[model samples]
Target chain A: MKRLVVMALVGLGLALGIAAADTPTTIRRDGVVLTIPQEKRAEVIGDRLRCLVCQNETVENSQAGLAKQFRGIIRRRVVKGETNQQIIDFMVHRYGIFVLLKPPLIPLTWLLWFSPAIALALGLLVLLLARRRRQQGPPPLSPDEHDRLKELLS
Target chain B: MATMLTRRLMFGLPLVAVAAGGVASYALLERMGRGTYNPQAFNNPLVGHKVPDFSLPGHDGHAGFDQAAIMAQKRPLLVNFFASWCVPCVEEAPYLDAIAKSGLDIWGIAYQDKAAALDLYLAKNGDPYRRLASDAEGRVAINWGVYGVPESFLIAPGGEVRWHTAGPLFPEIIEDQLKPALQRLT
Candidate 1:
């Protein structure tokens, strides 16, 4: 009976340890608690999203309070086992591409997508036009200078 | 006629010089603004200068991870930016834990993760970070020049960022690149 009780206690301890290992801790800061499952996929998702407040920052790097809220939102989605694209799409719908530091290419943002090429073309056109004007113009020479050069040679 | 030609040349020369100077200055300023001229630009070139003041709740839920305290120590440190949802970050997790176990001062900033989920991750995989700061706002990662997850930085005793490796670091990288860099930092 004593041996059985000891064995049962040890087994319970092992079981609890395993459970605790799998149970993720809830990190509470400033007024938010981010709950993440102890898994690999979820970690990646958190890193991919951009922080809305900090324009160039991904959700993972921004310290703005809004970033904390966004992270919480991502963590909830990850816990729900959403696919990466699904998670990203969900945020895109909520906040539009502006929330994404690296916004995906889509039809609605065609102007932003192609403006660089357009700007480059315009710059090249200006350079070519300037060069053409330079080529078309004749070199200036006064009559006296021209006559003096001819007299010197003669 | 010669005097007139000389006068014309003298007046025109200054105008040409001024125009040339103006054009050159504009081009230089444009290049600087676009950041095209500096081929080798650093994100957080300010490392070793001084670590920024960051006071955030730690992963453990009870304490604050102070940047100043971490910098005050003489030991070389490994600072990593990771997220729970990143695939590469998942792959690098165990390795970071291993590095921490090797008696090094390893600190982590959860780039953009929730506090609860981060806790869950550490509980499952094991916490390699002595103290993990939640960069739920990504403010710290930006300061650190982290563009992606699984980026690691090795800081020397004086707080200079000696080495920066971006991406999922492999075991061989640890043996070859990171270990050597850490050795040099110490």
Candidate 2:
């Protein structure tokens, strides 16, 4: 079924204007993980893991010795039919959450994750209050203040 | 009064945030300068967890030890990962020797090294490990969360990983972190 869907997508891409050679199913693109039949799942999982030695490169892109070992382990697990979650969890268990290329949302990262939205909300609130004040115009002047203003205008 | 309060708050909040950020940066810089912290290192998740299953063939002149051996240990010990080709491991030799001389057991795992190189490296530097093994495929090292050679783990009795360091263990580290950690176990 998955193969059928992938085949459909490839057909759709070819119809839409993507070259046959550029399609992911048939040919590997630059920075795309290796395209072996059994390695697709392993490649996806490895793409999210950081290469410790290279630091910036994902395990899929790094040429480091350790990255090669990671590729081996991930391929073995995927071939064994382990779920993607299990593979990612195993890496995290050994290497800590830092091994993840993209940080997961957790209690510690709550502020980091939500701060932009929080700031936007605060700005909209301030704008709403200011507009409300403007719509209300100036407060009704006290009798003495109204008389003084009238005398000054006359 | 309302305007004054608003003005004070507009100035005060950002000032407070900037001050807090400044203080944090200053403290981190000071610790880095003092050699008490490494910015590039992350906490190994295996700490406080049991050592996972692994077995490796014997290497060099020492017999191999496995997870069963680690579980049978009745006292705190060190699992030192070193490679014959790793420069930092050569730098860490004296510290390992010191730890061994202090009567604490050390189990060394040779990472991806040949027998002749291992024999030469140990003989020339000094053999501090009481028992030894080899992780020729690096599978065991990966399980142990070792990112690099010269990393050391302080394991508690029955194989609980207590602490780990990921560089050459200098004298200061041995005295400040490793010794205190061992003392706490005893």
Candidate 3:
């Protein structure tokens, strides 16, 4: 009975440890506590937004004071039940599309999205045309040249 | 005939592609150059929007900002975001002082700076702000969508942001861009 009780206690401790591991740590911002899910949503949104001050770093990765405050703003909005699009739109409205790390597919960005594909297609077409020309073997060397080659061999 | 056409296309197509690529890249580069330094050419999202209201602690022995009272003055307000740590802010101080003396209602919001340092800087350089507000955590400046210091906004009587300029204000910029905007506001 003593051994059984010890095994049961050990199992319970292991189960508790697993449960603790599953729960994400919460972050406090401006006196508001963000739950794990809320924090995750904020992080996802933050990762998509650029830190305007740092220029190259995303809001999620930047340690700039502005980025921290931006994260806090995201968390606050998340806690308030704003959708991801709503948060993004709010940021874009204030900071312009430059704030988005991955800008949406729009008319302005059409060249950016399609230029590489167009270039690749053009390159492949050129290669195929060149290969076909090479396979044709120099236009059969012309009929007169063929006859001249045959007489020389004879 | 087909081979001749194919050969011609093989040479012509690449030239056309190169020309197109050159033009496209030039256009893109020009656009990027314009977007970086020319804030006026690119539309500022904050322009025409109502300025966000903020009240922060006062520095340099002035009372804190009161947005309602500022709007109550019924004149165009020039809100300058500066910091004691920012070198451009120091360089632009005399221009701000000159603008203030010219009878424009100018106010300052100290961005992410301590009061003591701000006071020392103001004492040495000359305090140009009529009423100075301290943004210790920089929340107020963030609300204004200010990414850099030495940014100024000209607010219309009803609190609409008429014009905003980034970087230190030069005398020419004041005369060329700022003065014209202020004139339109009045």
What TM-score goes with each of the models? 0.43, 0.78, 0.70
Q: What is the C-alpha lDDT of each candidate?
A: 0.70, 0.87, 0.84
- Which candidate's DockQ is highest? 2
In candidate 3, what are the lDDT values of residues A67-113, reduced to their tens digit?
Answer: 88888888888999999999998888777788889978999999999
Best-performing candidate as measured by lDDT: 2
Candidate 3: tens digits of C-alpha lDDT, residues B1-186: 986998999899999999999998888788555433443332457789887777787875787776666566688889999999999888889999999999997888899898788888988889878888888888777777787788899988878888988888877778788999998977
- DockQ, candidate 2, comes to 0.69
Q: List the residue pairs that clash in candidate 3.
A: none
Q: Which ten residues in a row have the lowest lDDT in candidate 1 chain A?
A: A30-39
Q: Can you tell me the CAPRI class of model 1?
A: incorrect
Query: Model 3, DockQ value?
Result: 0.38
Model 2: per-residue Cα lDDT over B1-186, one tens digit each: 998999999999999999999999999999777666888799998888888898887885688988988999999989999999999899889888988998999999999988889999998999998988988878899998988898899999999999899888888888899989998898
Off by over 4 Å in 3: A1-25, A29-32, A114-154, B1-43
Error of 3 at B111 (Å): 1.9
Angstrom error of the Cα, residue A17, model 1: value is 71
Better of 1 and 2 by TM-score: 2
| Ranking, lDDT, top scorer first | 2, 3, 1
